[model samples]
Target chain A: MTDLTAAGRGVRRRGPRTRWGRLRERGYPYALLSPPALLVLGLIAYPVVLVVEMSLRDGRAMNISAIGQEPWSISNYVDVLTDGDTYHSLWITALYTVISTFLSLLIGLGTALLLSRDMPARRLLRTLILVPWAVPGVVASVVFLFMLDGSYGVVNWILRSVGLTEHGPQWYFDPSTALAAVIAPTVWKGFPFFTLILLAALQAIPDELYEAARVDGASAAARFRYITWPAIRGTTVLGIILTGLWTFHTFDLIYPLTGGGPDGATETWAIRIYTEAFSFFHPGSASALGILSVVLALVVVASVFPIMRKQFF
Target chain B: MNLDRRQFLHRAGLGTLAVAGAGALGACGGGDTSSDGTMTLDFPTWQGDEAGVKTWWRQAIASFQQTHPKVTIKLQQVPFATYTDTLTSRFSAGKAPDIVHLPTTTFGSFAAQGWLANLDDRLKGTDILGNWTKVQKTMMWDGHNVGLLVLGYAPVLYYNEKLLKDAGVAVPTTFPELIAAAAKLTSGGVYGYGATTTSHPGTYSEATWMVYGAGGGWSAGEKLRFTDPAVVKAMDDYRTLARYSPKGVPSEQKRTLFFDGKIAMMIEGPFVYAGLDKAAASVKSHVKLAKAPFVQQPGYPSNSIHVSTQASKKKADMAWEFIKSLTTPQTQASYAQLYGVPSPRRGAVTQAMIDKRPELGLFQSVTDSAVDATPDNKDIVTNFSEVQKLIMDACVRLQTSSTPTATVMADLQNKVNGAIK
Candidate 1:
């Protein structure tokens, strides 16, 4: 029987006759991996630590010299949590992130499934679908803006002509529609990436498994449930994580569209941090806010990763 | 703004990414200084038409450099939207140019921050400084007497000539006449009047006119008493103006309706006249510029107080000489003829100039009355946006919802006050 300690220590030993001996001979691989491991640690970890350190300090505009001197305080977090003006923005951002991520994944996976089936002219359709990703977010948002314009937008014009809407759909001016409109471009621009990834994952599954399932009298739905889903589940979860992070950090789409205005309906923390730091010149506060947002994002990622691993992998 | 360990570094989020990503759409290729002692003159415009502004600056520079053989000029045009990020990054990285055009609103703050070369000491005896009008006071910061205000626009009410004629409403003067005109023009879905919201740079020019005319001007020391009886009354008076406007008329909306002749009137500065010449020349004949309509107040000016928006025009080596040339009596007349826009100077105005440009009187009178927006230390550009937002919000609430005047005014005051601090 093999002892557990060596495995825990990740130790490999070379001996003549067994599998352990061969694996032990290849132990130098980890040494080669050390550089990247350290690079990620230095790049991702050091900044994270610095930011956390910053979040603990009080910040001010004009007195940039005070950044290092101010003692650690819970005041920033307290103020954010207690401030009535920002609370609604925070709530809206959270709801927006989750809903947009979920919808993006669902639509992405659906498109992936459909495209994977080898329909006629699938390549052309895929090209058309993926084109939105090529345009910069600001440009994409701007184009959509013109398309949804109240008076002369093609979509609104069609709707008005068809008697579906008399005036126009208040996509940006109205509060309820504003949040959704901002989220629309994110899902549109991002869905193609997720679709391609999921499709690749789907394609990687062996054709033999489907044939075997059919031979066993399994229904198409059952075969999909048994084989296709388990195969692509890992990729889907990774896609969701990436999509969620992107949604959480998205600024340009929301900023130009609503400007966190029309009654502050779209004022996400990102918009708040930007306006504070640049517009107001409150660098310390902006950095501190940035750190807080990053920390929250880390916690969100950390929490989600484990859940995804257990449920999907 | 402190983020805890987990949230501080998730730049994968677009918001965090935006910290470094705000202005990457810059046009490459910085202009090179040439042998005519060609110095790179950085020109910033609030909008595009790189070629047009560059041509204007190049011509101006070429003319100025002719007198100074050693001074050659090159123009580097930077779009206004990306100017702050581009110049700021380049400057902090030790790549600042010899001369650059700056808006008057930014002169105080930029000078206070030590970004500009002090011209105050140099301008004292120079013909350039001697020729500068009182309107140039708008560009002077407290400590740094650096820079000069060149291009200027005096704010006023702009009406669509066709719209007013169609509605049979004569141009207004008193508060009652204006309201009646707006009401008559506001029959159905059509709005009668519009002003750019605070989010826009144009809002700063408009709001100062409104508030200064209403018996007050903004300063941190004097906490905005927008809710004070006179201020509140001013706001309520504006609410009446709002009935003739769309629920929220952004700058784009204001520009479109006025150009399309959909809206009857807008609060605008002299820039509209420039736009009329170039972009809207066909419709230009249908637009009329007028003094701000009068407001009723016990102790305030009856006419809406207007102010000039100024910028420094660049000329190499003889920076002072270029400024002097621009402010010269003859040059001012030439400029008036070229653009048919207002001149903001104290010197003699020729009959020939007035014959070419109709509003020379208004421009001349307002030059004496132009409010100096130069702040004590920092750029009003920084604070003006916030002021615009707060006042815009108040106006929106006043117009759309039945939000109480006291509540909105107090809210705006608090936000603006907090920002300046």
Candidate 2:
């Protein structure tokens, strides 16, 4: 990852050096590139390969050095797939990932539209939207949990006050709604990134496109569908991909809120991996599961990549 | 930031390390932790208590330095939050703490991973485990001593005397009496009962107390008979208490309601006593640290349950020495004096703790009868997470609508049993 970032930095450092004509300009490229490369190789590549190796191997994490004595088995992968619980958790995770991503994008797009438009206090609104990210996941979970509290939350208060609800919602406690409670915070913490990315893309679009639509006498909705969306669809795909990745590994929101509870109503695969590996100390199995998650994520990216790439135009 | 060829190379290399190793380096304190003499200990405690713990350790280590002084210990307390993730990275990197604090439930897996030091020789030679209970003995994993009771035994209830007083009640002797007291103390706004049910100490703290208190024994039931009536009764009682809870009974959040005077009564382990005293001056005056009330059954005596602090066996010798010294009457008494925690050792919870904090008298009686939260089984504790999830699910369903409580209860029981097998 740093390699990619460093590649970007190399251009910045060298391009400016030649323009400025400094003595060390020639060396700047190597100077800028070498440190990060060597460090990444030493620190990242070594450990990651070790992890990838362990993922393929059949032993537990703590017993890594005991490789020869311990039997290497394919059972870990078998366990990840055949374990009734794993299958359940994967489905739950997939459901969580899909629902949370969709909801977050919708919420984020709405907010982006509102904030990117000529609204009074747009500065404050944009800043406020970003505040959820600033709130720690656990804290955000607590606050959201409190707000939608079945017995004592503010959401119920507002709802009942307006006669929308007689009592507050039992967000996490109710299985029917518990999954939603976990997803809400993901949308909250993460919508801002989506908004920022999409809005930035919107801003970068040439204003003349909208003007051209107006000159062609297109309806406001038509112009939005034609010019506004087509221009920013690429950024939206990227934003959703990023958010999807974030939600895929999301543990805190689900953990604190529901703990994947109500008899597995909200137990995402991440929570399952935690309970199995960390809580249960099933590392070999857990690592195998972890590898599965990475594969699942890659499959998602690979599936989405072609669509996103084509949309880039 | 101009760099000569070599310097630029070095800087670039370091930068790549910073990025490529973000998770690893971030997992470590900052960057490379391969320093020859320097060691990083991943001490996981409660999430928000890192700073206070660090500060306390700095003083404690400084004092310990008065002894041999040659060794430098960097006591890094991972933030109470993110503790699991922080440790997972360390474990993955093979960079776990030289010393660690393992919870009883988590010890099974950690030991299975060979994350724990075999403290067998350490415990066999030392008198530290003397004050420890045989019931707590089940916490022993793979027949090797993984961790020991370092700080808390378990938390019981700390009630607001003023709130209980205004409600015109003494701490109840039985579960029914306890319920009445809590119910009366509870208004529409003020919770009758307070519990720290959050995952860390509160979940274990109160869950252990309640399950044991209800006399739903943790020993294996007849083969495959996991859910007994007692277990159901215990779950029912917990669900009842959850109804009267302040702030929806988060494992850790109810302390706020208790401290804020919104809760009439709440159960906490010894861990929060010091912090509570700081929050409420009236609590010091009127805060009643009592054992959890017994579950009421006809012709049955009120049974108060014992709560254990999460245990650890990370620094085998040092941890045991600390536990042994702490449980020693003198050390326990000294610690009780320094921090308001009662010495968990029955003998060590002397008359002095009661004299200094008279509220401890209630705890003393409770402590005498306090028992272990059973099944210190690795499978059980690992499954405890599943249990909590199942119970919480039932809790959600029961609270959501007027569903048949039995359906919810049965579903939960089945889920727990399924996880265990």
Candidate 3:
């Protein structure tokens, strides 16, 4: 009991750590993460700041070098907000995104369910489902353009063989069908993403859960409702959010297919931004529209956050 | 030989940083200037890969290099669809090519941005001022000659002799007769007219020809005339003509249809003659060019060559020499012969050229009296791209909708007015 009370038997008391050592221990993880954080700031934040700055300048003729010297104003925002085309584009974007997302999710879920069962060439079929996604957007647009061509498309040929009608409708040029025609390729390209995600989530479900449901005398629909739906609800919501965002910002498909033609029937926000920037050479207006699009996307996310938090968080 | 994990990471990091630094330095470098005093002038053109045009360029470049041994012209090919946008991006980035070749429609925009060097001083002792075509006058921007006009021609009416003969139609010389002939030729997967009904940049030019033919125009100085009675009539006529043409086809596709023997008639520039060499065998011999069936001939400066402001003074002088070489009488004659289009210089089309391609006579006569179809008003010309969009949108509406021509034109007038302001 000689020094047990004071120094704990043969152990000496250590002095307090130095200030530099304490700070280093606290900041070591952040230092390791600083490179990626700086990259994100440079890549993402800088462009956003530049766009916001350009939106406040007069950008007629769109000389990028002269943008900094131009006088700053809110006229770009005023012009974008006051124009009727902006609202029309917003409406078109909403319709295209919602319909395309819903259809993609439905098709993806169906395909995933079909593939989850044992069948011949199941692996091959699953791999083949990704072909549409692998094909470049412009290439896919070109293919669909040929298939849905008014005068000589294979779809029209099939329709004629079945006696649907003579000289099938102008799918891309007709205002009534142009939006739907654009959405077809979009769904074909987008559904594979959901299929990949949902298939993983589907495979993770235990066989015991389905077997117990079967023994409990549940119907197939009931078993799906209790086990499959609950298991994949969170992933489905995530897929919807992601697909919605992508569809809202899609430009390559619609631009090459119609260039926002047929009297602006398929002109969405992204197309409008392009026409304003590259076509009209009005970078100020384009930047303003881009900022508004970001705001619109955030609003949509905010609206869906409550439901997502209830299920996912 | 025994590298620890930390040492390996240290070496890898240094290597990555070195590579990235080298890439950044490489990106900052512009046109090449070698130690032997040899300089490379970057020249980009949409016509660099065209069948006959590329031949002309090769010969021209070879001749220029023979004279200036230490100077090399680096010719780059850019597709016409994205040419202007590419140039604009380059100019904005302060990396403009030493030699700037642009569609005449976009010349004003580049000039307005000060990307093109003023060429009046360089032209003081040159024959370009007096001997070039009248359309070359369009090269003046804000009292400065910033470029040289390369090609100018009246739009030509191209028709398939086989289709017209099979339909028992004559080569029409008037708008009404043309429509009747088109109606006769249109049947069973074949079209009578081959207008660009899609939302294309060419749609404005196609519709503008109709407007000018109908004695209307987009603007007169600062005055907007989209709602003029003649314009309305022209737009209505265009809609009626669209019925006989294939729907939703762009200029290239329409040209393809004509080459495939599926289209009977189309109106295009004399450049279409070059494409006939690649047409289907059955259609190639049957295609012929005539004066466009319009009351007035519509023409504009097609393309031009200029020295960029971004080039050094020495390089710019070299660029000017290359451009001047292209405009020489001998080179001009060769260009007209090889390219099958009317050259900008006077007396460039020799009798031999006309004898080789009989269409040259008609091309010259029409080009001699062709009225400029582009907007002449300062504000309108400054905002031509926006005005072009409005016109294209109106054309698409007229083609795809049943709305009255008056209503569509009125909407366009309002939109164009707002755009110019």
Candidate 4:
């Protein structure tokens, strides 16, 4: 009877303590992660929430305080969604992103292939190629502006000297060529990043694979198709995704060059948002457009992922 | 000295919280006053680095400091291109400067937001009400005096006498004549005319002068007249003139071209005279000023000063005092002399000032007859930035495309109407 009473006491003592121990064990990882989780919540999640809230308000409020007093409505979203200019900007953004990304990748891939081969001053050339990427966007835009000046630009001088045409095209002033002109500088700045990434990926390919392919009567083209492409295909896809995203939001080069002018030919979604918010003092509309942009970007990514799934997975 | 994994994480989490809390506190903590009982008043202006205006402001600040030794005036230099946007951002963040200096074109938008303090009572005790020029009326918004107009001037035509003589083009006194002269002067790497042909903020002013010169304006009271025949004709004429200008050049670069004798003629404000000292000697010797070759003269308030509503009572009072010092007759006279332009104060340009600058008389006469370049409509004024954008867009369309001016203007009218509504 005394033995049974001692065993009952032991069970009673262990019950609450065992439950506490289980709780602590389950919560340990979360407790360790709370600091960084909270930081992300504060930094990234909070501003996004604020922007979403701001998008729902109605008014041309320039400040947060004034915006808070504005009436709650979805009119900003309705306005942004219904505006024809929004679609036009989206179209421009697509063209800019797609063309810029494709050109950057092509040039990057070519340069990476060249630099991969044993060549004279290969390291020096590789380092020097990053000069464009190193140049600040604003600085690059300014330099290109001077170089592309229609009347006094060195470009005009060269074109005239080479007997290309009687008069040099007004590269930035004319709408027909402004997009291409702005794209040139962007590609120049963007291609270097692709080169760096793809170059690293290329160096990882085994030389024995190429040597063995050559011995097996595989042509250079066939070798590249079977071995080189498969090896770097994953990195190229990533590079395209990243470069496309960057190009989609390009504002610095375009803003200083043309300001989406000569009839909004170069007006992308990002520039439109900026013009609406700062130039027109319509923050609500700007925020709405921003939200729509995120949605559009997600849609693009989702759609593209399925097509590229086999490579990534 | 040694903690278990959970304890270390708990302490790390606490440390992060404390660090974030400290950062938040630091960001929120801002005081103009120091422990020594000294105060600093934030003053931001695009003119902080402008040649003659910078010198005038330095002298004015020094004089004001002599009387108020405990108060420091912090002059923040923001580039003109980004000045308004920067100010808007600062005001939105509730960190508005104590003394607000705004371009007159952007003043109405700031005042409409109630970001500027009402100065009706402050103006009553001063001579500024009766003694200031007619353009001072621009400072009044919704029947309240909210700012003090400091600079007002008419646009003047600056010509190169040597270029005109070389090209055998007489000084133009009419729009058609001006175009003819500009065309004749174009050759040998020299542009016949200088204009802000690029997509820039100055495009607004450049387009305004052309439309106003032809006796058409963006609006009349609440009615927009963008589709008027006169405006279309003026824009068409402007397009023709642009062909003779350095393509895609901004106003500052256009001025540089003029100073370098690469541009034969340009229309600008009397303030452009302040830059004469920097002009090449060959160009300076041949530079001349005349009334703009247009039927009507374009003029507007250039810039103004105000006390921000965000300022504390003490800071507001100090700002008002500093502004008052700038308006005093002696200071106004000095400003007129230094700036090479007429001050807003009445009788600020004395005979001595005119004698010092023979061109001052023409500037004064032109100022007397000058029409306000900005529209008088309250709605348009309140939504000036939007209207300005629409107009600038229209101007670009006219300049770069073969689009019919009437079609462009009609489209602009619809956009402006929609914007204001």
lDDT of 1 by residue, A1-313 (tens): 8879887566443343576866755764775577689989999998677656655676542333335676778776666656676667678889778888888888988998899886899989888878877878899888877777655668778988999988776566555566777788778888888888988999999989999999999998998899999999999888888888888878988777767765676778888777665554444455667877788899988988998899999
**Model 1 ranges off by over 4 Å:** A1-89, A205-227, B1-56, B127-131, B187-190, B219-221, B246-249, B278-282, B296-325, B366-382, B395-400
Which should have the higher lDDT, number 2 or number 4? 4
Q: Model 4, residue B25: what's the lDDT?
A: 94
Q: In candidate 2, what are the lDDT values of residues B120-230, reduced to their tens digit?
A: 676687666677544345446566565654443544667888877777888876677777788788885778887543333344445446666776654453332235677
DockQ of 2: 0.25
DockQ for candidate 4, please give it. 0.60
Global CA lDDT of candidate 2, please?
A: 0.63
Q: On residues A219-265, what C-alpha lDDT tens digit does candidate 2 reach at each position?
A: 98998898788888888887878888889889878787766675577
Q: Please, what are the lDDT tens digits per residue for candidate 3 over residues B1-421?
A: 9999679869978998999999998888744567688998888999988878899998999999999999889999999978888987888778899989999888877777788999999999888889999888788899989999999888989999988888889999998888888888899889999999777877888898888866778778768888888888888888888889998787888898999999999999888778887899989999988888899998767899999988888889999999999989999998888888888899999887898889988888899888877777877777778788778888888887788899999999888888888
Lowest lDDT sum, 10 consecutive residues, model 2 chain A, at A61-70
Candidate 1 chain B, which ten residues in sequence have the lowest lDDT sum?
Answer: B299-308
- Tens digits of lDDT, candidate 4, A1-313: 3799889898878645677887987787897788789999999998898899899988877778667888899999989888888899998888889999999999989999999989999999999998999998889999998888887889988999999976798888777888888888999999999999999999999999999998999998999999999989899998988898889888898888888875688899999999888877888899999998888888988899788867563
**Each candidate: chain B TM-score:** 0.75, 0.75, 0.93, 0.93
Provide interface RMSD per model, one decimal: 4.4, 4.1, 1.8, 1.5
Weakest lDDT window of 10 consecutive positions for candidate 4 chain B: B28-37
For model 3, residues A169-269, the per-residue Cα lDDT tens digits are: 78887888899999999999999999999999999999999999899999999999989999998899989999999999999888879888677889999
Candidate 1 local lDDT, residue B312: 30
Q: Write the per-residue lDDT of candidate 1 for residues B1-421, one digit (tens) a residue.
A: 7777447435335674575465543333233444344553443344325322334445566777787666654455566656555644444334555555555544433444455665666567666645555555555556445566555544567788877887899998866687788889886555688865324454444555565566655543444555567666666667677667753346756777677666778766554555554435545788877777744111111110011112133433345565555556666555555545454444556666676566766655554455553222242344644555566556546655577776777777777666565
Give me candidate 3's TM-score against the actual structure. 0.94
